[model samples]
Target: MKLAYFPGCSLHSSGRDYDKSIRMVLGKLGVDLVEIPDWNCCGATSAHVTDENLAVLLPARNLAIAEGMGLDILAPCSACHQRLVIAEEELKKEKFQKALKETTGKEFAGKIRTLGILEVLMGKVGPEAIEKEIKTPLKGFKVASYYGCLIARIPRVKTFDDRENPTSMDRLVDLTGAEAVDWPFKADCCGASFGITQKPFFHKLSGRLLDGAGDFGAQAIVTVCPFCQLNLEMAGYKEAKETPSRTPLPVMSITQWLALAMGFTAKQAGLSSLLVEPGRLRETVSR
Candidate 1:
């Protein structure tokens, strides 16, 4: 149960809650994550667009470091996972590998197996195992899960499931006895860095997703990516302020929601900090 873990920049910064909860929950599930040494930022949004070389090299460097340790990598953030995966794929290209090795003095076989944290958990433990661990049932909750772009939408890459219609979240929700309703916007974008550069624009996109969730009778939107959580809650709240809604759907990381179902404290699960608390869902779990 030991694997190389890449938290990426967001996990350490705005997504600290994600990192904390991930560790706690994994420990609860009996998994060990060994952080990669001196791992640099994954280049995120700007890397691939501005300079392809840097985008590939940055994650490649981390993969190289992981390979050195003889451990497969498990990435938590979708962006980081995508970048690392993309870098690994790029290095596999005969031309790319030769050029990269000569320039960077690094050896890459694309040998490292990169997995999204969700993939590892859902596969290694299986839905049946997770079901047994649920201390409280989320019987009354209706959560619409969000997967965002990078994790499952990259064309031709190893998307864990269908990009447009994902079942990973739905499966996890079902294990906790919560209903998982079909959400068309499950694979939609939340406007990455645009959260700052284009706040208004991103908020509108986020609002559309939340509005979609509410339309589907969702009590909350569960997610694995932090960027998705940030936009889904903070931006959705702002939009709800401008336009009144019956229930401002709360945005929750899958980790947080799972912790809640397992009866973890509000502080431990980072619930109260959310602008729109999953109060209704909280009541459901307490019972």
Candidate 2:
């Protein structure tokens, strides 16, 4: 399978782990990911809150590029996936489509579809195929698969699993021989960028997620979004303020976990790059 990969901004920087492991895992699965040239930020919340036209046009530029590549856009970042998909839907409107073409001097056929990495993994690469690729099953491991928001909220937008209680990530976890605990807050919002502008609010929202994962007896929290991973990692510090102190539960990308099961080294899978380190969990998996 060939896909036009859009790493977005965060995936290239703070979310490098998601990028690396996804590339490695996809390569192992015989999937070729062609990076989109000259891709820019999807504008995320900023462009939407600022200028209406900019929001549509910003992601439309990348969509046009992906359309040219003649492949679906595989965006790992939840924000990028949501924005790109939303922009594709918006561009269907004659006004937005005409405006976009006038501004960029390019006609977007709305042909390029934006898909989250989870969708590609669970949908394109079936769980059976993934199970076959696993060299080291995550035996005795237990985790809460956290989907956060963006990926599963809107029913109109194409999503991998249920909007409320997504099990795509959970099933993927099961494929590696890990127990995906039936934990709450699977679709809960982590306050997204609110973690930056409002620390107290961010902590309150993220703290609940962290505390819930521990309360459910999970050893770690598996995530697909970088913002969710970052917020949950920050919550490791703030969680003590609310609940009884416990060992910091590692917040990691789903791809990172899969990479480990697929026999990739810790460094190769970008496990070392996580803010809330998974060293203890890695040691446990090794033994």
- Once model 1 is optimally superposed onto the true structure by TM-score, how far is the C-alpha of residue 243 displaced, in angstroms? 5.1
Clash counts for the predictions, in order: 0, 0
TM-score, candidate number 2: 0.95
Top candidate, metric lDDT: 2
What digit string (tens of lDDT, one per residue) describes model 2 on residues 220-277?
Answer: 9989998888889878845544554556788889998999899887777776766666
Model 2 spans > 4 angstroms off: 238-245
User: Residue 17 lDDT in model 2?
Assistant: 84
Candidate 1 residue lDDT tens string, 96-212: 677667776878876667888778879776777777778877777788988898888776686787777778878888887789988788888887788889988887788788889
The residue ranges of model 1 lying beyond 4 angstroms of the native Cα positions read 98-104, 240-247, 283-287
Question: Model 1 — which ten-residue stretch has the worst lDDT?
Answer: 278-287
lDDT of 1: 0.82
